[model samples]
Target: MKILFTSFLYLIGGFFTQSVAQPARHRAAQDSLTAELEALRVQGHFNGFGVAIVSGKGVLYQQGVGFADAQAGKPYDLHTVQYIASVSKTIVGLALLKAQELGKLHLDDPIDQYLPFKVRNPAFPDVPITLRHLATHTSGIRDNDFYLSKNYYLRPGLPLAGLPMTFDATQTFIPADSAVSLPEFLRNSLTPEGKWYQPKGFSARRPGELYEYSNVGASLAAYVVERACGQPFPAFTKRYLLRPLRLRDSGWSFRQIDFARYSRLYGSTTVPLPYYATTTYPDGGFISSVADLSKYLHELIRGYQGRGTVLGPASYRELFRPQLAAGNFEDRNERNPFSESYNVGILMGFGYTGFIGHTGGDPGVVALLFFDPTSGIGRILLLNTSYDDRPSEATMYQIWNTLEKYQHRVGG
Candidate 1:
C-alpha cells in the first residue's frame, strides 16, 4: 500500500484441506470458518485476525479469532487493523475513477501531460505511456521505481535487508535489519530520472508494450493524482475516497510510535532473523480493520453503488480491465484444464468468470479480495499469517465452484 518490496522467494505453501462441512445458514458455517482461523493462530500467524462476509445489504456471516500481538497476548478485536498491502491499488483505481467522474482528469491523458516533473514522455518516438497503462500495469517499466535516480546503480553485495526503501519495482528488497525512514523511501522514488529499472537495468520500450508491473508506475500515478487535483496523496485519497466512504480508521502515516496496533513478522527460523522484533511496513502501508475492509469490499462489489457523485459503475469496471500483459508469468502458458491462471501468483480474478481485485503479501500478511459480477458474491480473506503459497486463488475458485456444485446448499 505504501512501501516498495522486492520479489520474495515464494516457495509452494500447504493449506489445510479439510472440507467446510457446515451449512451456510446453520451456525456450523461460522464455526467451521472459526476453526480454520484458530488453526492459523495456534500455528503462530502474524498476530490477531478478523473476517466477515456481507451480502445484499449487511454482513451475512463473520468471524474474528486471534490476537493483534502474540506475546503481549493482545487479542485482535473487531477493530484490530492489518496492512492491506497491494489491495490499496484498487482503492487508488477507484479514486482515479472518482476524479474522472468529477472532470478533474481523464484516463486517456498522458503521464507527462499532468506532471510538473518530466514524467514518462509517451509521445516521444519510443516510450509512449499513459494513465491507463499505469492503472492496468501495461507500462513497459519492469519495476515500481519511485523517483528513480538517473545515476542510480544497484550496489554489489547489497544485502537484501539493507537496500533503501523504494517504490522502484526493480530494486530488489528483503526485510531490513536497520532503521530507514519512510520519507527516505518516498523520496528515493522521485530520483534517478524516473526510469523503469535500476541497480541493474530498465525496460527501454514505451508504455502499452507489455504487462510489466511497476510499483513506481503506481507511485507515480499517486503523485499525478496529487498534482492533477492540487492535493497531497494521502489527503486526496481521504477526501475523494476514504472520508466519503466513512473509513474512520483508514490512513497512510509515517509516525510509528502511536500506531501500535500491529502483528509480528514470521520468516524462516533457519534464516535466524530476530523473531517478533523486525518489520518493514512501507510497501504495504495502508492499514484498516477487517470490518472496514468488509465494508470496502461490499461497496466495491456493489460498484460503489449509487455513489455517482463518487465514481460511476462503468468507470469502476474499467479499472480491472487488463491494459498490458506482464511478461515472465506462468499462468498464460500453463494449460491446466482444471487449474486457474494467474498474474504472477496473484491469481488474477479478472478476465475469468469472477471479476478482479488483488491479493497482497508481505512477510506476515496475505490478503485476498474477489468480486463476482454475476452473483455479487464478493470474498475478502485477510490472513494474519504469511500464508505465502500461491494464495488460495485456485482454492477460492474451488469454493466458488463448490457453492455452484450445490447452490441449493448455500441457497445462492
Candidate 2:
C-alpha cells in the first residue's frame, strides 16, 4: 500500500481523575517517561516537538520541547500547533464518515452524484468511483508527474490540477486565492471540457483494484462532503467536530491558531520555512497540538471500545477498515512499524495488538499519530523537521518499549 504522506478540543479523557486520584505507581511511570522524552529530544536535536500518551480513560502523559519560534526563543509546549501534512487525511476521512452518519451521503454512492462533474477512469468508464475508493487510495487517481509535466503551478486555463493543487504540503509557498478552488479544480479535472484535462490522471487499472496514493482523490472526497453537507469542509468540521469537542486550539489553518504558539518548521539550514495554506484544505491543511489531539485520541479509543465518541462507533469501524488487498506489498521494515495493508486513511500495524493512525512528512515537518485500542493506549509525536523518512529509529523503538512497559505496569 502506498504510504500517504502520510484535531480537536475536547475534554473526553480522564484528565481530572488521573491527575487527582491516580495511583502513585502510574504517576511515577509518567515522570520517568517524561525524562526519557527530554533526553531523546536533546540527543536527537529536535527543533520543536510535542509528545503525548493517551489511554482509553484519558491522557496519561504529555510534554513538549525545543522552540515554537526558535529565534524568538518561544518554548514549545502542549499548545504549540504544527501542520500535520498527510495526516490531515484522517481528519477528512472521519468527517466524510460523519457526513454519512448524518445521511448527507453514502460511501457506496457514485461520487459523481455529489460532484458537479463525473469522474470515471477513462480506461474503464463503465465503473463508478465511490467514496470508499477515494478513502482507501483505490480510486486510481494518481498525482501529476511534476518532473515530466512541470504543472506544479495552478493556471487559469489549466483543466488539470497538479500535485500542489492537492495542498501546500511541500510547496515553498501557499498559492494565491485567485488560483482554482478545490471544487473548481476537481470539476475541471474530472470533466472532459475543462482545461488541463488528461487521461493520464486516471489509472488503467479499475477503480478499487489498485493502491496508487492520490491527494486529488482525498481532496475530491472532501469537496463531495461539502456539497452533500451544505457547508465548507473546515466550517463543517468546526461545527460538528472541533467546537463540539471544545478543541479551541486546533483548527484547519494557521490563521485559526495562535501565532506565538505555532511551531516554526526547520530544515537542515538555519532559516525556517514559511507556513502553508491550501485551497484543498481537506487534504493536508489541519493544524493541531498534542493537548488537543489527545482528546481526539481518547475519543478514538472510546469508539474502538464501542463507547462514547464524537464520531459514531460505526463510523470509527468504517474509518479503520483495512484496505489492503491480499497481494499488496507491506512497507514494514526496521524503520517503519505499519503493516503493508492500508486502512481507510490511517495505517495498520504496531505493538502487540496493532495500531490505527497516520504518519506525515513534508519539507520541514514530520509527525505520527497512532493508537493501540486493544491496549487502550495511543501515542502522538510531532516534530518541526522532516529529518528522515520516519523519525529516528531509536526514538520509535523507545516509544514502543515505553508503551509496553507502561502497559505491563498498568495491566492494560
Query: Which candidate leads in lDDT?
Result: 2
lDDT of 2 by residue, 221-264 (tens): 88888999999888989888898677878887666777567787
TM-score of each: 0.69, 0.82
lDDT of 1 by residue, 383-408 (tens): 55443334433333333333233222
Model 1 stretches with alpha carbons more than 4 Å out = 1-28, 43-47, 121-126, 144-201, 254-260, 268-283, 304-309, 320-353, 388-412
The lDDT of each candidate is 0.49, 0.65
Per-residue error (Å), model 1, residue 368: 1.0
Worst 10-residue lDDT window for candidate 2 reads: 7-16
Backbone clashes under 3 angstroms, per model: 29, 9
RMSD of 1: 8.1
Best prediction by TM-score: 2
Candidate 1 lands at a TM-score of 0.69
